[model samples]
Target chain A: MFDKAYSGKRLDRDDALALFNSDDLFGMGKAASFIAENLHGKKVYYTRNRHINPTNVCVNRCKFCAFSRSAGEDGAYAMTIGEILARLAATSSPFSELHIVGGLHPDWPFSYYLDMISEIKKAYPRIQIKAFTAVEIDHFTKLSGLGLRGTLSELKSRGLDMLPGGGAEIFDSNVRGRLCPEKIPAARWLEVHEAAHTLGIKTNATMLYGHIETYEDRVDHLMALRALQERTGGFQAFIPLSYQPISGAIDVTRYPSGIDDLKTMAVSRLVLDNFPHIKAYWIMLGEKICQTALYFGATDIDGTVVEEKIAHSAGASSAEMLTTGEMINLITKAQKEPVERNATYEEVSI
Target chain B: MRLALHPERVVTFIVDRNINYTNVCVNKCSFCAFYKDEGDEEAYIIDEGVLMEKIRETISLGGTQILMQGGLHPALDLSYYTSMLQKIKKEFTINVHGFSPPEIAYMAAKAGLTVRDTLAALKDAGLDSIPGGGAEILSDRVRSAISPRKINTAAWLQVMREAHLLGMRTTATMMFGTIETPEDIAAHLEAVWRLQAETGGFTAFIPWTFQPGGSPLGRTAGHATAADYLRVLALCRLYLDNVDNIQASWVTQGIKTAQVALRFGANDFGSTMIEENVVKAAGVAFMVTKNDIINAIRSSGFKPAQRDTFYNVLNYF
Candidate 1:
């Protein structure tokens, strides 16, 4: 079974299930790492990027969301275009990508998102503006009565370079129904990514695992993304977001064990073979686990995220941003060469 | 190995009995509760008859080797060990994986022999391979503090290097999680890694946390958590890239944690000890059988293969 994955053969559902259920964790890790090394060598990809969440006011509050706030709440304040520009101006450090995603603010019209991205692009023309998630796009379609195509094309015209993979809680409707009933269904999430792909807009995909999701749910989620990648070949990377249960309706006391985290990382790498990269988003997984993740088939450590708000709001202990030197040290310690990448994964000099 | 080559979905374990010949010793490590003073009622050495009986029992149970490590006994001369090995080899057709670095160094010093000559003599006396022991942490500062009378870091490495040059493959071990920082752990791994790179004689590397149960260092610093164990285990696997096998200590860590260690870079599940005394003295007695290991490896989605003392696969389950 591992020989198949080792020989660059795509794993089927049974193989994935066997891997997920099997305790032969090191074998799975080796296979995943073989694929990773074969594809990227020892190079560990990271982006020089900043996360800009312009607002927190969301209409549909998901149970797993710790960042979203009701309108008029104490922390609920949308950044005006000028304020957003000022925030962007505060960083003197050169960055190559602007990762923008936020709550589905019902009051903000679709033009607001368009103008916000346009203004950022106008200011930083060279920086790739990977803005908005599929759910946010779905919100825009509802708000402006523009279908998915109309909303995505409009955003793309206004300097939206790529879609930041988010709001993909879990693909299993049984799990999603309990955690995020108001959020877009799994079908809508896939359709939105597919629509963006058909328009030739490159996007990343994510699966929020490790909370209220079964192993079968996780397998289903990864398989769906794999199927989508087979169809479009547009997913630049697959980010397995470990669910942070801060301020969520589905309350749990424990985070997933380090074993579970590494298993998920390894399995994702093995399962999502067609995807070019698998990101260990260091914001959710702290620097320690992220460093260890390099061996468990993680090719990308997300980025030097200068001020990420989402994971922090959910009790993540990592700093909002890691210095470039810090990230380099981690990659070097893991015996991986640190590579600075743009939003679309073009290797760039640090 | 799968990482070095293509991925193979097989995990191996050895069926061997760890025969502790004598618990009575001269150098009592602060972390060990297994040793006894010469006058203690519990300080009886294994008579030749009992030793042979244990060997027969091990062979009857389908064990391929006998791992004999013990406290450095002051009264027994080097002949006691050489004759014991000779007698075992003469009587039983079993591989004798005996004598850790500390034991070798102690015996060498007592017998006025150099480390190299000592290893040559032992090899002639049917010592097939060396088990990695007495390496609590290879840093001199940690070694000086915990086991002051035990062999120092250099002496342990010297024993291993001389044995390797003599073409005797040995295992490397680290007993960590006591009064050592991350730097100490890294230093221990680096020492073993450097030696392995040079000689390439290490058959496996095993790292287990210090059990502070009934030791003189009892419960002063809490035992290492499963996370700590796994982190170090993963780091050992990543760092000691030259070592062929990374063994998980199911005795120190329970079977479940050891099972999880398979994914974290443990290829060998270590020995299926018919009897173990050191860790049990530290208050952990996780007895595992042949079937227990086989099922654990198989249920974990790996082919459970049985190996000899030198990691040669005898058969696959």
Candidate 2:
């Protein structure tokens, strides 16, 4: 299996499944690390970004979502364009990207979403706006009475530079049924992404693991992403979100252990051979495990997210923010060179 | 290099229990989490009966040795250590691999005897060998920063040299990832390699990371990743050519990284510690049974063998 990976051969479904079941974690890690080094050397990429979940008032109450709330609920919110601009202007530090993913607000017209992107882009023309998931894109298509390609083209023209990888929770239908039945099916999610890619918008991909999903489900999800990337070549990176065990909604009782987290990261790096990067999202994995993941085939540790609410709503215990200095310190201590990057992963020159 | 030295593809481990006799100490090192003040409620010297019970339990579980170490108590003398060894030797047939260099230096000073004389007395009372502890970085610059009240580097080496002259085989250890530079690590490995060259009394070279969970250094010092641990482990194997054994530390790095350490040039699986408290007190504990060690070794493509204190194979699993 390692020989195949070393020779630059494409790993099939069986090869990925074997990697998932094998106990040779270090062997697999070494192979992944070697490939990462060959591609990027010791340079680890990070970004100075802010996550803005404009509102938590979502119509579809996905069973695994802890961030969404009903319209009349106590904690539900709907952020006007003015409020989002004010929040962005209040930040003192400079950032290269604004990661905007929010709940699907039923009452807001599709123009409200389009105006939100244009307003932020007009104000901060230098910062890229990576907004909306395929689920939200599907919601927009319904709200605007347009086709998938037309909705995505509207978002693209409104300065939506890229798509954030959310709502790709698990591509398996069985697990998706139990996880978020009201949300779009796997076919619709794939169709939305494919349309967005065809329109020339690069996007990130994600998989929510350690929940009710089986190893086969995870491999199937990766293979689907691989197949898509092979055709469109639209994925900028692959992010594996470790499922944080919440109290009431999700039935999972515990978080994934460090071994499982590292293995998932390593396997993703090997199987997603077409992906340019594998991100260890520190918001869910914590600082130590994320730092260790650098050697397990991870080339990027997401970003210095100023404020993250989605994972925190699900009971994540990591710190709310890490300064750029802190991010460089973490990467440096792991003996890797830290590279500050923009939304598309180009090195951000000061 | 590992294949050249250990051509049999056999990895070795010893089944032992770490019995810390006393926790009361005067030299309150900043990086240590197991030491306590003399009058603290948790501070205690092990009762003789409880100590005997621990040894009996270890023997019943197929353990061949007891790794006895403790804090530098101000009131204990040479008589205390000699009588403890005599009592244990008189009772059981287990090898008593006890006392690190710092403890020996302190006892010699308190007893008004040379280190050689002190070691001779302890050996006569059935101190079979010595286990290396308290040698954090083998550089006075690092020792002064982390443990100013403890022994200096020269004193630590002097104690080891005297023990070696007395025909006692001891192991050498380094606790890094705590305010240490690459030069300090190189100096540490060079120190061990030079000593092994001179006396050839060192049995193994064990290197582990500093756990900064419950210690004072936790505020300023960060933890080392498994990559850092493996990098240092591989460096130890390449640099210390005189030392025949390089043991991987499962207690600090966990079992997965330790299994990977075998490929990083480690030939020994360290000890199957039936009971461990020092690292546990620092808020990181990884407990494994004898079978777990054997299985980990076998799965890593090596034969797991049980060895005595002197690295003699007793059984191959």
**Highest DockQ among the candidates is held by which one?**
2
Query: Cα lDDT for residue A182, model 1?
Result: 92
Estimate TM-scores for all models: 0.59, 0.71
- The DockQ value obtained for model 2 is 0.13
User: What's candidate 1's DockQ score?
Assistant: 0.04
Q: What is the lDDT of residue B239 in candidate 2?
A: 97
Candidate 1 residue-wise lDDT at A129: 92
Cα lDDT tens digits for candidate 1, B111-154: 99998988899999999999999888998898888888988888
Tell me how each candidate scores on DockQ against the true complex: 0.04, 0.13
lDDT of each: 0.83, 0.88
Alpha carbon deviation, residue B31, candidate 1 (Å): 24
- What is the C-alpha lDDT profile of model 2 across A107-177, one tens digit per residue? 89999999999999999999999999999999999999888999999988989999988899999998998
- Candidate 2 residues B131-194, lDDT tens each? 8898999999999999998899888888888889899999999999999999999999988888
